[model samples]
Target: GGGKPLAPKNANNAAKNSLRVADIGAGTGNLSIMLLERGCEVVAVEPNDAMREIGISRTKDKNIKWVRATGLESGLEDSGFDWVTFGSSFNVMDRSQALKESHRLLKPQGYFSCMWNHRDLNDPIQEVAEEVILELVPNYTRGVRREDQRPVIEQHKDLFDTIIYIEEDFYFHQNIETYIAAWKSVKNPYWDLETSEGQELFDKIAYQMRHKLPSEFDIKYTTRCWSAKARN
Candidate 1:
C-alpha cells in the first residue's frame, strides 16, 4: 500500500553499473534505494523537507546526492542522467512541465520512466475496501495514477520517441497495522483528512478494515509503467 516497489522488465539494463539516474520527487528515496542496490549513481530530488530528511537518514552510508527540488524544476545538470524516473510522483506534477524537465535532464536517447503500483480493485480484499470508500464518497475517483500516460507522452513527440508500457501484477504481504499505516499515508483525492468528515470517513474505513482483514494478508497490486527514449 504505502510501499511502491517496482521490478522493471529489463532487469539486466537496470542493474548495469555506473548508470546515472535522476529520481524526481524521490520521496524518502524508495526508488533511489532500489537504484543504488542495482549499482546506479543516483540524484534524488525531493522538495518536501520531512521526506528528504528521512531519505538522507536512510541512505546516509550509501552514495547518493539529495537535492531539494520539484519534478517540474529538478535543477539538475543538462544531459547528465542516463535515466529520469518518477515513482508514484508524476501525478502530483504538471505532466507537461515534468516531461520537459525530464527531457532536459537526460542524455540524448536516455530513458524517461514513470510508474505507480495500483491496488487491484478486483481483488476480494480490495473490493471490500472499495465498498467502504464508495459508501463514504460516492463520487470518488481513482485519480490520474490509474490513467494511461501514452497520449501525454506522445504529445511531446519531438522530445521523446515511441513509448513502452508495462503492467505486472504482484502481491504484497503485510500485517494489518502496516496496511492501515499505508492508508494513512495515502492522499485520497476525494477526502481531506484534516476535516471532521474526512476523519470520520477514515475511522469508518479503519474499523471496517479491522473487521474484514486478517491480521496478516496479501494485497494484490499491479505496477503500471510507461517509458520512452528522450530525443534530442
Candidate 2:
C-alpha cells in the first residue's frame, strides 16, 4: 500500500473500456474520480457525512453517486456492480464481513481491489519524517495492510481468489508547508494533531523541518494493490 495505489493501472482493458463500480469506504472520492475518468459509473459509499461531503465536492464526478454506508452493510443491492473497490480504507474495515458484502454486491465474477499509497520512507526526507513521527509517538502503529488480512480472505476461498501484483512507483511533490499541512490534516482516529501532546509533537516536526529543510520536497511512494476475483 503505497503511492496512491497504482493498482488502478493494472485494470484490464475491459475495465478501462467500461465498468460500473461501487467504491466502498470512499473517502474524499479520490479513487472515485479516477474511476470516473475512465468512464466508469461509480457509487461512493462512506459513513462519515463530512468525509462523504468532501469526497462528493472534491470528485465532482457526475458518474458518481455518494451514499452514506459502511463497507459491511453498503445499503446497496446485490450483484449490481462489476467491481467493488476499497481504496486506502480496507485495512480498518471489518474486512472479513466487508469482503462478504463486496462479494454480495459484485456481479458474477466481479472484481474487488484494495489499494494504498504507502509512504516512501525509504527516501531520506521521508525517512526523517518517519523518524520524527515515531519518536513523538512510540506506540503509534501504522494501520494494517492487505497482508494483515490476506489470510482471512484466502482461508474462505469460496468468496474470492487473491490477485498478485508487483510494486510500482508513484511520485508526488509538494512544498514544505503543504507537506506539513497534509500531515496536520490527517483525521483524529489516525493522528490527532489538535490534541496538546499531538500539537507539541507536530510543532517539533514543523520546527525541525522549517529550520533544516528546503521549501520544496519531492516524495517518492510505492503504490501497492491487492485485488481479487469475486465469486458467488
Q: Largest lDDT belongs to which candidate?
A: 1
Worst 10 residues of 1 by lDDT: 1-10
Model 1 over residues 38-84: C-alpha lDDT tens digits? 76778999988878998999999776999997788777899998889
Model 2, TM vs. native: 0.81
lDDT score, residue 17, model 2?
Answer: 48
The lDDT of each candidate is: 0.84, 0.76
TM-score of each model, in listed order: 0.84, 0.81
Tens-digit lDDT track of model 2 for 108-140:
878888887777767888777777777766776
**Candidate 2 clash total?**
7
> Given candidate 1, what's the lDDT at residue 118?
91
Q: What lDDT does model 1 reach?
A: 0.84
Q: Candidate 2: which pairs clash?
A: 1-118, 2-116, 2-117, 2-118, 2-222, 2-223, 3-117
**lDDT for model 2:** 0.76
